[model samples]
Target: MNRVDLLTRSDALARPASIAVDDVSVTYPNGFTAVRDASFELGPGTICALVGVNGSGKSTIFKAIMGFVTPSAGQVRLCGLPVDKAVSQNIVAYVPQSEDVDWNFPVLVEDVVMMGRYGHMNLFRIPSRKDRRKVDEALERVNMSAYRTRQIGELSGGQKKRVFLARALAQEGRIILLDEPFTGIDVTTESAIIDLLRELRDAGHLILVSTHNLGSVPDFCDQVVLLNRTVLAAGPTATTFTQENLERTFGGVLRNFELSGHALHEDDDARSLNVITDDERPLVFYGVKKGKKKPARDKAK
Candidate 1:
């Protein structure tokens, strides 16, 4: 067998890690298409970023992968098993977007985080001291231990995000799917969360995050999956961030920028203004219009 075929077969037969999404697609009951013929494979000990604009099927894909939304076509597998089956076994943890959660539910932060352990505890059994200790460790991982007793409603947006993350940590799953974890948070909180995710990845967990923030993907993710109702691109950031692919994915809204000598310049300016003309192709500039030409210097004759 060829090298590629051998690798594929080996991966298929290998022990499952956290989550694996096959050719999964989702359609609403009203016949509206959300995700179309999408497929991706994620292994343990890796961080993947799902990037796209609004209504680009990022969250829809997440829902299908998590078994929250049934797929109209194809199958979603978790750790080599079907998604529905995996959910019952608590093999996956989902941290949803904060906007979808109601802050007025009147639950303490610690209680909410401790809820993650419910899957492990018997339906009617009380949490043991070990479970409580797991909860404590989870809260500590997200740096939310001090606010454990505070009401969820009293916490700031960043703190609320951390509480949800702590819940995921408490679950102790090998795979985690997060939706917009950095939304509406301060940079400090965002950085802290990123660091925590890295630590989790190091511990052999598979992490998949859907985000609109492209700036952080390169630094934080080992792979990037770009979607727009379909799999526009999927691969390493360096390979998938090409101008041709981005333009096709983002259409006319795609803008490109380049940094040189601590200054950012647009592709249009770099070309029309005659700033630099070499064999190097300029980056595509999106959104911004070409600026007016500067006045010519007076002759010294």
Candidate 2:
């Protein structure tokens, strides 16, 4: 058996990136303004949620970062390098939304993952033993090793997402951009993805996930960028991802359901459990007494 060769993680994603989007704006040829005056900064070792609804300029922001579309104004920097330079260096990996992919296209799961390594390959784009090893390792990391031989279209929705995630991991880019990763997946699969993202964050990768899954934002994300046509708020999850900010960005009230602590058999601490949701699912949080000092910490804390 040939010994496996791999790109050392220290060399691939050696250090965290300081990502900054300062006063950016994107305008299409049709005189359409996707986003205007949007600004947000994210640190390394953090998972930032780009929160918005449909047509809220999430894709525009992503395109700007990847250098796919030049911003009409402002700058996007990755680790102090310009977007184009960063892209040329393969310092970023993007997992586009499922809707952008053709599931009917015939491709093996492993081959799909191998696409991630194309940037690192020579002009011929032939897979070396090291490239093959990276693909295998990435598949194994996403628990998709058993499906390596399966056709991409034959897998479940959640499995397809995992395969793409593995592709990004194989690329070993220091910065990852995920667009609606949890959209069609179940709670279990979503939770698993979040866990993996947390692991990546701890490993010094900077992750930007564009998601409207408000219920799960506080569960794992370290930072939040609230956007509509422009950035409404941006900062730590606990502070910036608040009810008021969400309402302001989404242009609606966050439906809430309250369950008394007594209902859960907590007589001493009879605080009511408030479930905040954007018609997704219940996001659990316990409210403090109006006169008290916010109870030191809550679930999201």
Best-fitting candidate, scored by lDDT: 2
Tens-digit lDDT string for candidate 1 (186-291): 8789889899888777666788999866556666788878888998888876667544555566675544443333144543344221111111222322322234
Error of 1 at 43 (Å): 0.6
Candidate 2 TM-score versus the reference: 0.87
TM-score of each: 0.80, 0.87
Clash count per candidate? 1, 0
Worst 10 residues of 1 by lDDT: 272-281
Q: How many backbone clashes does candidate 1 have?
A: 1
How much is the lDDT of residue 219 in candidate 2?
78
Among all windows of 10 consecutive residues in model 2, the one with the lowest summed lDDT is: 292-301
Residue 97 of model 2 has an lDDT of 88
- The sequence of per-residue lDDT tens digits that candidate 2 reaches over residues 160-203 is 99999999988878899999998888767887888888878876
